[model samples]
Target: MGNKTALYDKHQEMGAKLVDFGGWDMPIHYGSQVDEHHKVRQEAGMFDVSHMTVVDVTGTDAKEYLRYLLANDVAKLQQKGKAMYSGMLNEDAGVIDDLIVYLMTEPGVAGEWFRVVVNCATREKDLRWMSDQTASFDDVALTEQPDLAMVAVQGPKALELAKQSVSESRATLIDQLSVFQGLESEGWFIARTGYTGEDGLEIMLPEDEVADFWQALADAGVSPCGLGARDTLRLEAGMNLYGADMDETVSPLAANMGWTIAWEPQERIFIGREALQAKKEAGISEKLVGLVMESRGVLRAHQKVVVSGVGEGEITSGTFSPTLGCAIAMARVPSATADQAEVDIRGKLVPVRVIRPSFVRNGKKVFD
Candidate 1:
């Protein structure tokens, strides 16, 4: 038996195929994964994301502590409700975990508060690292919100559906929030952010209320999707998978996550900044890129990628793209490679065209 989310029973009730994901028994799909994928891209879908860890960092030194912990500058988020995406790094400049931090404001709460959301698989390690860092700092506190159950309502109708599901007080606050901003009401926190490439709200409510909320969304015509569709949807959006696209072994730059790194505010150097600076100056040898199998056969992870006249690399994340009607993959290859590459599929080298990313968006194909 594995750890289960608060919505575990709800998933089983919907006839979901349960799979073990990072020690958690999660739903892979309810019926057809392909259909679920289509539902999100074209209409509406909801996912139980309670497995993700949400932590609140408080006290006077909260902002300063996070500035030293994350690679991106937390100072940029000066306004209340502002959010920033950054990566926590190890001493070696490798990515520890990618996360989102929101600057919050409560009705009588003075000083600044931060809410951080981290990957479910790396929650323990992340919490440990955070604890170690905060032990020496006075007036800083970290509290894990285990009582919260997160649900992501996504697609073209996501916002509209969310307005109907959330409490009136939270609905108004969330309605005023921009992308990446979040609002907290009673025990529920609603964030206008999501992993899926669509307009959506990630609502965090009491675990006890999860089942009723999911059912309400279903009754409102939002399809209940599972991890299978979430994976395909995020892949099509050019988003990186934690363990696949990056881990403790790879730096953000090498994984095509350079945009997430904050290079300015040179005086505010965080962990791995020196190493990242050195890499930037030395010039990158290999880089992450997108590949589409030109021939027939699905691409998969760890497949050998041989670039003609360049060099070799490996596919980090790959899948049979439902929208593209073909195989698409994200691979780290020699930076010298220009137009094409080949992937080793079953002892046979299959040609693949190298493109940028964002293969699918808004229910349509964006790239070949």
Candidate 2:
């Protein structure tokens, strides 16, 4: 048995195939992963993402502390409810974890506050790092919201179907929410952010009420999806999965996450800024790029990527793209690798085309 979310019984009742993911017993699929994946891409689907870790930071120094903790600048969030994605790094500039932090309080307020959602597998280490970084900031405090549950409703019709499950006031707010923005109302944090490369909302509400909400969405005809579909959807969207794409030993520059770092305000320093700056000065040798194979074969992680004359690399995450009808991957390769590469599959070298990391967006192929 593994740690179960508040909706464990609900998932079982829906005939979901449950699997252990990072110590949590999660639904891998209800009946068909391919079907579920198509549902999210072509129509609407909901995923029980309650196992994700949610933490709230509040106090006199919350903003300053965050600005000092994350690689991306939270100071850039000039309005309340705005969210930004960032990587929390160690002293060596290696990615400790990647997360989305929302500015919960009005900008420039004395009571600085923010909400951060992190990967559940890195809960202990991320929390410890966050706490230790706050040692110098006497006014900051961390509160974990273990009592909350999350659900992600995604696809083109996701917003309409999800709105049918919430209160009228919330529905109105959900309609008004802009992409990458999150707001709190009636004890719920509804954000228009998702991992599936579709228009969606990730709502965090009380655990006690989440089961009913999930059922309500089901009654409204929203498909209940699981982790298997979630993985393919995110991978197709070119989003990086922690532990697979990068970790404590990999630099953000090599993870296709360099855009997430904030380099300005040279005087204001974050935890790993110095090391990252040093890396920048020394030069970046490797980069993460996309791989596309137009054959009838599936791609899997850890496959060797041989860039002829350049060097060897490995696929961090790979999957048969449901939206593109081809195998797509994200691989870490030598900085000079370009245009073409090959993946070793069962001792056979299969040629692949390398392009920008993104493969699909809004159910459309993004690469040329």
Candidate 3:
């Protein structure tokens, strides 16, 4: 009896194994999650990401408001359709959420708009925070776009085959999209973005038109994947899982997300700036890094990690990497941790290798 997306029926029709995700009944997998994972790496796959919250921001003060709201500077977005990834923080410098914001319109355009996509589970608090911050800006407005449904088409042939599923003109538009840019056409927002660590597009269109589009992609030979594959794929790509890797209690500095924080210009005071500055001055004691247990067993979240004498840490997200054919994990460990560590697996302390936080990219091992 959880909330359902507009594509819920379609997922059921395709024999998806539905599970509760962020209060929504979502497909965990259609069949054989490992097989589906390989499909996306080898060819193309489509996922129903309609449950993600999309909010549109506009008005005269929109730009200024965003600059103050996110840790990253939006002033760097020079042109329309460009997108940036950022984290919203509380006054204490804890990560509220990680999101992507797209500059919807350029300067002097009719409507200076920005679109933000946040996690489905954190929508309520995220919206509340966004609106509360807007109270200082009289002209700013936030519009929740529940009428839109999103689908992420991904893999090596993702763009090429997905283009054939849409109109010829839309196909041409897709070809023009760069890595992180997005554009609107015929009421649909097509963005060159994805979570699978592969080249792909996330298309937001009217909910009514989504079923037809999804079916067309299936006709074009794109496989229908589910959350199980999605999680493993993103993990292989070294992307952080919200609740597992970070939450309201964790700072971005400890979550391997320090790169997302923009600390320049000194004057741009966003929420959590003061606290994050103090933390930077104090030094980060722990860090998020990649763990490789290539021997036999799989690594999982909540497993205790021992860094010999430094201290203990815990795995945030871990699994058997289908692409790498080995077990990999992201763990928060003592900053002093180096090449070797041990993970407590089933009361047995198993040795592991510590490396950079990424494992695979473009179907190959990336970490040294």
Best by lDDT: 2
Clash number for each model: 0, 0, 0
Superposed Cα deviation of residue 290, candidate 3 (Å) = 0.6
Report the C-alpha lDDT of model 1 over 1-368, residue by residue, as the tens digit.
99888899999999999999888999999999999988898888999999999999999888889888899887888667778889999888898899999888742247778999999999999999989888767889999998899999989888887778767887688679898878778878888888878878888899999899999899888999999999989888888889999999998988888998888887886888898988889998888888887567899999999988888999999999887788999999988988798999989988999888567877787774
Q: What Cα-based lDDT does every candidate model obtain?
A: 0.87, 0.94, 0.92
User: Using Cα atoms with residue i matched to residue i, what is each candidate's TM-score against the true structure?
Assistant: 0.96, 0.99, 0.98
Tens digits of lDDT, candidate 2, 32-90: 99999999999899999999999999999998999999999999998789999999999
Residue 266 alpha-carbon offset, candidate 2, angstroms: 1.0
Q: Is candidate 1 or 2 superior in TM-score?
A: 2
Write the residue-wise lDDT of candidate 3 on 187-237 in tens digits.
899999989888899999999999999999999999999999999999999
lDDT of 2 at 293: 97
Q: Which ten residues in a row have the lowest lDDT in candidate 2?
A: 104-113
In candidate 2, stretches whose alpha carbon ends up further than 4 angstroms from where it belongs are none
Better of 1 and 3 by lDDT: 3
Off by over 4 Å in 3: 107-110
Local lDDT at 230 for model 1: 96
